[model samples]
Target: MSTLAYGCMGLGGGWDNNPVTRENINQAHQVVDTALEVGINLFDHADIYTLGKAEKAFGNVLAERPELREKMIIQSKCGIRFADNEGPKRYDFSAQWVSRSVDNILERLQTEYLDIFMLHRPDPLMELDEIADTLSVLKSSGKVRHFGVSNMNQHQISYLQSALDTPIVVNQIEISLAKLDWLEEGIMTGNADGRDINFTAGSLEYCRKKGIQLQSWGSLSQGLFSGRDVSHHPQHIQQTAELVRELAYKYNVASEAIVLAWLMRHPAKIQPVIGSTHLDRIKACAQAPLVTLSREDWYNLYASSRGQEMP
Candidate 1:
């Protein structure tokens, strides 16, 4: 898998009930072409993205150019359901739902097997034994080659892994310059201020220790540190944007590369899922691996974003 992945969240049109149009399919083709051109082979998707139209749009691209499938590592997630007659919007981990959702995801993507099938989120009502059995069946049937989880804490992942024969290979979570909880969780340890951080303690270390790939979801921070407007934003955000611009010029790479390089600098080897659909932004993001931030520069950017000196 590449250190960077092209996210398909923005591939399909809107999140409405509208069907996938030719325009959507063409856009998917362009995205795929650019990602591949820039050496991004992994593509990320979720069943609920754009109401499943995202997968449908990519499926159209694959159906027309079957050869491209061989050049990609396709992964998708499930377990999130929207509100309907069944019940209010909730996470479902029942055997029936997992099996049915996998089938639908495969059908929409027009693929034989997913490189990695992730559980979108934890279901409060999930039965460990039952869910493990369901995933075991999927693996036996060759529908899913590997399994992973998203938005799960270290305890949740360890508990789930204990019940399964296969290892949980990836843990996707929100990690970016804008979201500093993951980093602050470590720095603020043994301090009262750490109590307010939302990220689960030891989550990052657990993944690194267990050899589980840590994939970042909101890795770009919505271009907050890149080129997005920040006039109304906090002082730290505006300052971080200016620092990112300086580093981009110093390293001779795009602003996107500087922003992502901050996350890549961590020893965890995080795989950032770049969610941009624009060709220029995609290319800019692919330049991240080319520029590695030194420890001093990395700390400068971190402190600038946090708007405080490290304790």
Candidate 2:
């Protein structure tokens, strides 16, 4: 069984406005069941996800089915604060905020500890020593089993890693066929042409070297490969979708599976986080681990997605 993680961001209805309802709880329960049915053991959540409604709904289902907790690995993130009554939209890495966020995450998930707790984003003003000491305290107290960060570059992760004794287990970032910089960075190096690819500096190779599991968010690229409107999409997106669709037909799997399979094919072992709320789409995504793309096919997809053959 593939260890694809299910993202709960789109759960509990709309974000910033709609509070989690009983209907949302019911939907969450169904989604969780579907995820487990498809061998997805990891559930990803963030404190800001739907204003915590995602975790609330998840907690509701777990409250009813406490047994299911043993069958899953629960992870949640913090450090991102929206501009409501607070100062402005910002990232807070203060020990106090991290502690409080974990408390709320635990309460909403109806759990004693999170398998993994991540900083949602890098706070420019983060105090390394203070954050490290704080995370060490949390780990010792058994509030969080492991630590990580999201949307962080290699240097940011390196700075954090330098302070902590525990390893940063994962780095979740936006990665998809549509977002090709991870691949482009290595390809463009030492070339005279010097393509302008704004990838996080050496983060992909760094993660591979450090054994940090790379978890991909926005993994499906908003379903561009899964029958999203080709007419409205860019020419490259259309070409990428076409190639993905052709591969899907050849591999006898859904187009989403092909898209995700491409990510999984990377040597870094990138885990794609699926956020689809639709049951059928979720099931289709589960087929990703089953499809293995050949070397030729993988490069073809990459070249097609890049809208040009390699130089």
Question: Estimated TM-score per prediction?
Answer: 0.99, 0.97
Which digits, one per residue and each the tens of the lDDT, describe model 1 over residues 1-311?
88899999998899999999999999999999999999999999999999999999999999999999999999999999999998999999999999999999999999999999999999999999999999999999999999999999999999999999999999999999989999999999999978999999999999999999999999999989888999999998899899999999999999999988899999999999999999999999999999889999999999998899998
**What digit string (tens of lDDT, one per residue) describes model 2 on residues 22-86?**
89999999999999998998999999998998999999999999999989998999999988686
Model 1 stretches with alpha carbons more than 4 Å out: none
Candidate 1, backbone clash total: 0
Top candidate when judged by TM-score against the true structure: 1
Taken over the whole model, the C-alpha lDDT of each candidate is 0.95, 0.91
Cα deviation at 266, candidate 1, in Å, is: 0.2
RMSD of each: 0.7, 1.3
| Superposed Cα deviation of residue 96, candidate 2 (Å) | 1.1
CA shift of 116, model 2, Å: 0.2
